[model samples]
Target: MGHPKFPSKHYDTPSHPWQKVRIEQEAGLIHQYGLKNKREIWKANTKVREMRRQARKLTANSSDEQFQKEKNLLLAKLNRLGMLDENAGLEDVLRMTPESFLERRLQTQVYLQGLSSTVRQARQLIVHGHISIDGAVARVPGILVTRPQEKSISYSPASALNSDLHPVRPGIQETFEDEVEGKTQDNEKVKGESEDNAKTDAKTDSKKDKETETDKEEEKK
Candidate 1:
């Protein structure tokens, strides 16, 4: 991919009014991919442009084997990302863009993997060193996980140890349910105690009133 010539500032609009629709598209990509900035999208665009450039170059000769080789490489990469299926064809590779490449990233895939609650959380978990892939610690949120490796993704035992039921722990949600039930029981107990206290106070007041009335009668006599 060519080195991006653009500045690092976040772009709200493309400067040209004709590119106004791009702002919406860019924002959607950022939200959907959980990107940190618009620069990332631009970076992906350049990267895809480079890939397309390579494809165009390789196919300039128009040899069958060259085309197949390029297709295979793209397929392998995409399959590693868990995007393309087992029966994907060369036509699919032609349709592959940088967005397709980005979608396969570890952060996005992990979110789609249903490990973390959201895309950003998946990225955070990865960057925070809370996640692992293929039984090896993978701290890079941008790591593109293969389908087989995706199965291997798991939480660090330490990270899993102490927390309210986060998405990382399936067992923790059940524990949370138990905790809620316990709280409900505790609340019922408190209510019962409060009712008992009210009854006792009422009885005491009644007794005191009767005693006062008797004292008044005695005084009168």
Candidate 2:
């Protein structure tokens, strides 16, 4: 309906944009998921809102046979998107959160599958066309990964990320190991320093005691 060059806004801005609690929650999600900005969170929230709205409409028309079919279809779609379980009902859809939608994104899935060290890196790889879905390059990090697509997600055959020697290939495991080793070495160094300081203090106290004993003996003489 509108100009194709400028797409309609997919998300609604909050009524109270400066609300403290909402801002804190959004900040946590942004950091936890390594999101580019709050717009990603808003997009997920919009998706959840739409799903719940559809569920409400279906429930209100429970008497219609067509409604039942549509409800089943909706459930299947949500289930495929990993937002609902196998036995999930309309209530599950109604209870869905923005986080559930965000978790289904290609970036999150790629990170979860151990293809990248962090969500940010996953997004980068995807946006750079290093990732693929069903053997086709998928550049959109925000793509909703369905159940079938989940299995098909992998580094693009032509991408350097597919190589074992690639920097990001080892992902979290190598970095985690290096972090643990570094921490252990740091602890050992701190312990060694503490022991050395204790020994120095004990020697200083012993020397002072000896000096005091010698001075008392001379005074008595």
The TM-score leader among the candidates is 2
lDDT of each: 0.73, 0.91
Off by over 4 Å in 1: 1-18, 64-71, 86-90, 161-221
Pairs in clash, predicted candidate 1: none
CA displacement after TM-score superposition, residue 95 of candidate 2 (Å): 0.7
Residues 51-85, candidate 2, lDDT per residue (tens digit)? 99999999999999999999999999999888899
Cα lDDT over the full model 1: 0.73
lDDT of 1 by residue, 1-221 (tens): 44489645432333574576888888899898898877777766665666566656655645678676876786677676666776876556556665876776888877776677678878888888787776667788767667788687777656762365463554565677789999999999999999999999999999999999999999999
RMSD of each: 6.4, 4.5
For each candidate, give its TM-score against the true structure: 0.60, 0.79
RMSD of 1: 6.4
Off by over 4 Å in 2: 171-221
